[model samples]
Target: MKTLLIWCLPALAWAQAPAANPPGPWSGGLGVGNGLEAHATRQTGGHLLLLGRARYAWWGPKSGPGSKLFDQLNTRSRQTELAVLAGRSLPVGRCRAYAAAGLAYLLGRQLGDYRYTTRSSGLLWGDATYYYAYRRYQALGLPLEIGFQGPLGRNQQRLGLALQANFNPERSAYCVLLTLNLSSWGNRIK
Candidate 1:
């Protein structure tokens, strides 16, 4: 019985051992559905990272027909945010899932054009003219994100798919992004 128990222990240990290390810093991919997402992260420690990203979308409401109106009115209907994130990875099977929260700067604008009438009839129609105004609002936002990351190439590069939610005083927006970690650029750091 002792011999059988010892043999089983080695098998159990092998089964419970951690998976191999994921490819390093640079990793990203392309696909169809929403859009593309890319990111770069600098590791500060074993479980900490500083991240930044630039994203673009071509099918969203903010980028469609209404965009022309916003351009004409000198208002911005799109979004560009800069953020810093920190999170830790929890191993799940062969992959790692992470949850991160951070702060971001939200920048965008809105425009409207309307006419006001003093009377309901055509008599006052001449008195009303085109009224145009541009509104611009900028605020700091809180961003919360969760996603999974894993190895893609033979090197240290990794690919990540994540969902990011931005909370602002006025409104909130959600984005799905695919990120690539540029491990090559990261290795230059001493």
Candidate 2:
């Protein structure tokens, strides 16, 4: 009985140790929508994401602007973006959330031609030329999210969703994202 008690005490101590919770290494997804801006112009674009992305964040924000004309000239611009994310485990009822903020760069372009009159000659000129330009802006914002993860078929996988709100010196945008995760790939020893 004394020998059995000594063996069981070590096992109980190992089981009572708190599990470690660390940030995930890599995650990516594909999504298509036009809720980033509040303009009539619909934007179609995809982003490639890298997790633990704190090193290269010094590049700031990415932005662009443009003008379109159909009898009347219309101009538009975008200034900021936010990324909110989370992870969870249902068996343990555990969850975590994180937010990131940065700057955005803006690009501008003209899509149509408009007539201009020469101030000195008083002569009307009908010439069409496209214009392109870029501008840089700063932004600081955050996003919040929740998620869950567990074991599946000898492999560990996680699923999560997030809503992000980004704000910059000029404007703000919102994004909704769905994430899928597969982990424990390289830790197996056969």
Candidate 3:
């Protein structure tokens, strides 16, 4: 009985172990999706990013006049991102799933009210003030995504959906995107 058990254990382990390098060619794709996201920036009302504060704070351009004295404060900002990635794909039932990680860049801007009073030529210059809601920021981050795709029509193109996250030193952002991919996968999974 002991001899039989030992032989079967080795066989089971070998069959269940995964390969070091799976069989597939490296594939790439481009996707775009919108989700509730947040970013880190050097502006007022940009900190204390706990809870759900990050999603609602930075979005769209601020409204109102850009004057020092009668200026209106803006509590919102906007962010735009682009990423490039490469990875492999595996078949899951009738669909193919892939995971990729690479670099991403973000552009952000905000508007705010500013008031200043200074001395000019040794005289009180209370009117020496100017304001414009202008703040722009840029950041680089690592982005990872996992998604599933299937054939699109008769061509080698595929349409899929994915969930992605961007990791950086400042903050982490997430999204859910619809993806379109064209790769070397061919008709292997059909």
Candidate 4:
């Protein structure tokens, strides 16, 4: 049994290897739609990449019996995250597809109790028309993503579409991103 296991280990490792090792450099991508997404991908070896990503989202309150400055449907709660991810890409037809998972530091910020105040003394506080608040937050998150990539022009430029699911101790959501790569800055072997 031990000899059989030893023989299988090498086979398993070989099965996971890429058909070809394509050395790559650090490439940056910017994404839009369903929030903002940005990443820098640098190839460590073969199809492996180190991805640094950043994202931001918003959840706003509606008009609710108050006359605060934000009551005009022009305000939002801010949520932002930053992460370092590792991914692997494989060639599929004319494109390359990848999957990545990472931990993110998230910050959810917004006003808690909001109100409008009049300078007129103490006995004139009213209920149905004011806004006041403090900031709220959720600190940690995990993000999982899958994406497809295609070349754009030259210089290792590419375009990508990514789908992501973000999980936090307090909140969770899904987002889709359309990404544009500017250039590969890390690998000089173009």
List TM-score per model, in order.
0.57, 0.33, 0.44, 0.64
Cand. 2 TM to true fold:
0.33
Name model 1 segments beyond 4 Å from true. 1-38, 44-46, 56-76, 111-134, 186-190
**Cα RMSDs of all predictions?**
13.9, 18.3, 19.4, 15.5
Number of the top candidate by TM-score? 4
lDDT of 2 by residue, 126-183 (tens): 4343233334455454432232332221233344454544444444455554444443
lDDT on C-alpha atoms for all candidate structures = 0.55, 0.33, 0.50, 0.67
For residues 113-134, what per-residue lDDT tens digits would candidate 4 score against the true structure?
Answer: 5556433345675333344574
Minimal lDDT window, size 10, model 1: 57-66
Q: Candidate 4's error at 71, in angstroms?
A: 8.1
| Model 3: colliding residue pairs | 59-77
lDDT at position 179, candidate 3: 62
Across 99-188, the per-residue lDDT of candidate 3 in tens digits comes to 666677766665555443333463554333334455676788787767677643233345678777778654466777666554334335
Best by lDDT: 4
Per-residue lDDT of candidate 1, residues 1-190 (tens digit): 9999999987655444543453344333332224345556654334646476544423223443234433333223345566777777677655567788888887655444433323234754632222334446688888787877664333444556788777888446678876644454444343
Superposition error at 136 for model 1 (Å):
1.8
